[model samples]
Structures are given as structure tokens and as C-alpha cells.
Target: MTRATFEIEITPNETPLLPGVGRFDFQKVWEGDMQGRSVGLMLSAGDPASGTAGYVCMEVFEGTVDGKLGTLAFQQLGTMDGGNQGLRYIIVPGSGTGELEGAIGVLNLTVDEGTGEHSILLEMSSDH
Candidate 1:
């Protein structure tokens, strides 16, 4: 398994899916064992002003993992309630392309409260 860390930048998009919902597009720059970038879209619902919300996101990542160049797709599910939060990123089955064919993994994310910096820890492996 390889562990890679990354920093993310999210931008709100003008596309509105529904009232009281938010749509955002994001880009991530990965470092450490994986060097690359990922582009994704996020859809969020619920009340963020009261610290209760949920979101789903899909992203396609293109980059080098363990020196292998390819692209992989991920789906993220997350929720926040008051001071508590939960998030999970899963690799889409059969969504790997190029050198990442047959890739499998899980990703975890953490945000620095003081700095508001977004980071991810990807635990990844490939069957190819």
C-alpha cells in the first residue's frame, strides 16, 4: 500500500441543483508518494449554518503513483453535524485507466482547523 498526501482548492460553481443546496468544483494537487492533480465536483445539502450538512463528490485524478502514470476515479461521501464530521473516499471499481488499471484504494481527508488547509491521505494499491 502507498500513502499519499494532497492539498485541495475548492470553488463554488454557479450551477444550482436545488434550493438550499450547493455545487462546487475542486482541484487537488497531490504530493508525497503520488504526484498529480485531480478535478472533481461536489454536491452538498442540508444546513451548513447550523453545522449540519452532507455531501457527495466524484473526482477523476490524473497523475503518477509510485512512478506509474495513469488516471483513477473516486467517489466521496461525507457528513457534518455540529462539531462532529465523517468522510470517506472510495476508488471507483474498474475506473482506473492507463498504468493505474485495476487500481484499488481508500482515501481519508483531514482539515487543519487553524489554517483551514485541506489534506488527504490516500491508501492505494494496484492489481495490475
Candidate 2:
């Protein structure tokens, strides 16, 4: 089984690039499900109301790939366009599966129309 948890911080939204406006920062933690390699988020652009994109970083803290400690780096999970996309995860190899228990990461979020800005707060979690 896998579990995902997150905390968000909002920022000013961009306008002329989006109608539904808001920005968010992501901080999340996960428990490995697929042999401790479980990481990633399934993103959806909410609706036609959502006219922005989403990008995030996934990092590993306490983990190993074949016994070698995992590195601290952020990989682009994917783009969350204005539509419904399925679930996904960041790959940390042997590190995420069972090597990590006190890992930390950050998520930089945005929502805009390229004119104005609005930031929102959201907390989300999932387990499977």
C-alpha cells in the first residue's frame, strides 16, 4: 500500500493566463506501496474554470537504491493542464520503497490568467 500527504501555501495568481486564479506551494510526505517505490500525484486541472498549470518537485531524504543512499533532488512529476489527468508518482527507486521514512519535499504551484494573482491553501492526502 502507498500513502500520500501534502500541505499547501498560496501565492498571488496570474491573470490573462487563467480565469480560476490561485497559486500554491506543496509540502508532502508519502509511504511506499509498490515495494517502497511509491511516489507521485495524479493531477486534474479542476475544470474549464481552471486555466493554469501545475508543477512539483519530489525529493528523497532517508532512502537507498540497492543500499546506496538516495540523493536530494527534485524531479518534474508532470504538468497539470486544464483537464482531467490520471494519477502519477515520482520515482525514487529502492529509496522510496522502504528506505525513506523522514523524507521531505516542496511544491511550487501557480494559477493565473497572466494579469492578476491569488493564492490558496489546500491540504490533501491519499492512501492505497
Best by lDDT: 1
lDDT of 2: 0.35
Candidate that would win on TM-score? 1
Give candidate 1's total backbone clashes.
0
Residue 40 local lDDT, model 1: 98
Weakest lDDT window of 10 consecutive positions for candidate 1: 118-127
Cα lDDT, all candidates: 0.87, 0.35
Off by over 4 Å in 1: none
RMSD of each: 1.8, 12.1
Model 2, span 1-128: residue lDDT tens: 12322333333334333454333333333232211222332222343346445544444333332343433333554444556442233333333333332333333333355943422221222122
The lDDT, on a scale of 0 to 1, for candidate 1 is 0.87
- Per-residue CA lDDT of model 1 for 1-128, tens digit only, reads 56666788899999868998899999999887788999999999999889999999999999988889999999999999987989888889899998899989897777788987666677777766
